[model samples]
Target: MSVLSAAKKVFYLPIMIGEWDMATIVETVAAMRVLVAEARQAGKSIGFVPTMGALHAGHLALMQQAKKNCDIVVVSIFVNPTQFGPNEDFTAYPRTWAEDLAVCRSAGVDAVFHPPARELYPDGWGTWVEVTGVTDKLCGRSRPTHFRGVATVVTKLFNIVQPDQAFFGQKDAQQVIVLRKMVRDLNMVPEIVMVPIVRDEDGLAKSSRNAYLSSEQRQAALVLSQGLAKAREMAAAGEQEPAAIREAVLSHIQSAPQANVDYVELYSFPDLAEIAVLNQDVLLAVAVRFGATRLIDNIILTPSRT
Candidate 1:
């Protein structure tokens, strides 16, 4: 073969190759676009899951759902700073890159867009995307700027990856509600998919911040899930009063000596508006603080039928 033919065989030929065994990790938006564009040109449907770097079973579960739904899955891991409050653990957020990639590989993620903070928010960056009403409840009340940061980064990720569908875990039910509303209101193209929360054997929802908890704190953290469970039971047992449901959840979390209850709210699903009764589908959410680590859990309640 001629030198030109050999170069073509080695370089250009590889570009047209059909598959990626694991995920291709790219650190810049430009690189992600090029990779995704090639996949789009090949007529493959893309699915995306945006995350922070500390990979857990929940993150893998999202990717698994993406794999089942779309032809390609892109997982972006950026520890977005805007989402964290001034006192929150932005610096302390875990960044286990090596283990994260391994999990992506096992879960069949197509590409991993792990951009640096500087690249995502360049010098003199000022724009943000915010969703109102829904933002006023749950985790939003305490972390005022949290959803704004989440909205902005997710919008940027959707614009960059432009997936056919994007996946998020139901563990952050408020986040799911906010993003769905944002996509619908803005008329975004990609479908927002909500996967079920993955919990530990002990029933605590999986989270990166769970790593921050000491043994006692971890034990205390179970109350968040347990409280939501009790609220679920109340709704299932023909209880429709919002006040009663909230009280039941509060009582469960209060039983934990180390647990500090933040909020136990029952609100309308998509709109997140207040409800006097639970006649319709509602979200039961709880946030509790154990030492310095804060955790949140939720369950969606559908009215019981005779």
Candidate 2:
């Protein structure tokens, strides 16, 4: 099937063609499916970016990357409760619907799936999708139930939208790994596209939860990135031992008065196996808590042999 060009204009009559400001926003699964079906019938390639509300530059960059590849782009803004732990910030998570829609519109998103939790979960929801191995480390060790919730909601969204491709940011490195494993193991069809993490001028990863940071807490959050950079530098300088690299990261994070180090781990890429030597490409991940707020950052690095 020939794919429609990203620049090609389509008309539905009464509505103007080739307009980003006219992006459609739908809240129901039924409506979202109808729109996806119509796009497919038109020979348009669909790109999906699923996210919780409170749009940020990172989310917008993902949408922009989607628009560059697919003729029709769909973004979901559901703040999934299942992904949060009992004492976690499910109730406190930011949800800026109007601003999110504006960001989507500006990015030329064809549809916005802003479904309510009741509509998606309803009652008696029992089944969930989980990928093993990859989820057993990194963020999973700390937030045990997190990836289960993520996989379930992502599977539901994929089923509901059935897009040609899905976009995800690399900031959530383990998440991308788990979702990729889920797609392969479950035989799902949507092409998984991993976009690089967009960061602030000071190198802090852009996250919705960053809003919770006080001025001091915000400064303290930099320790996550700092620790990751230090570990990467050590790997480049021929530091092959995992224990030494981890210690470097922990010490830097612990130096910050407001920061509490969560975990500093090194693992082989994709496989996520713990590594002792810096002989190949690996993932360096760190998490730090700034008072009540928790922040995470990671970098994929290739060890520099001396």
Model 1 lDDT per residue over 164-186, tens place: 99999999999998999999999
CA lDDT of every candidate: 0.84, 0.84
User: In angstroms, what RMSD does candidate 1 have relative to the true structure?
Assistant: 4.6
The residue ranges of model 1 lying beyond 4 angstroms of the native Cα positions read: 1-23
What are the runs in model 2 whose C-alpha is more than 4 Å off? 1-23
Model 1 lowest lDDT segment of ten: 7-16
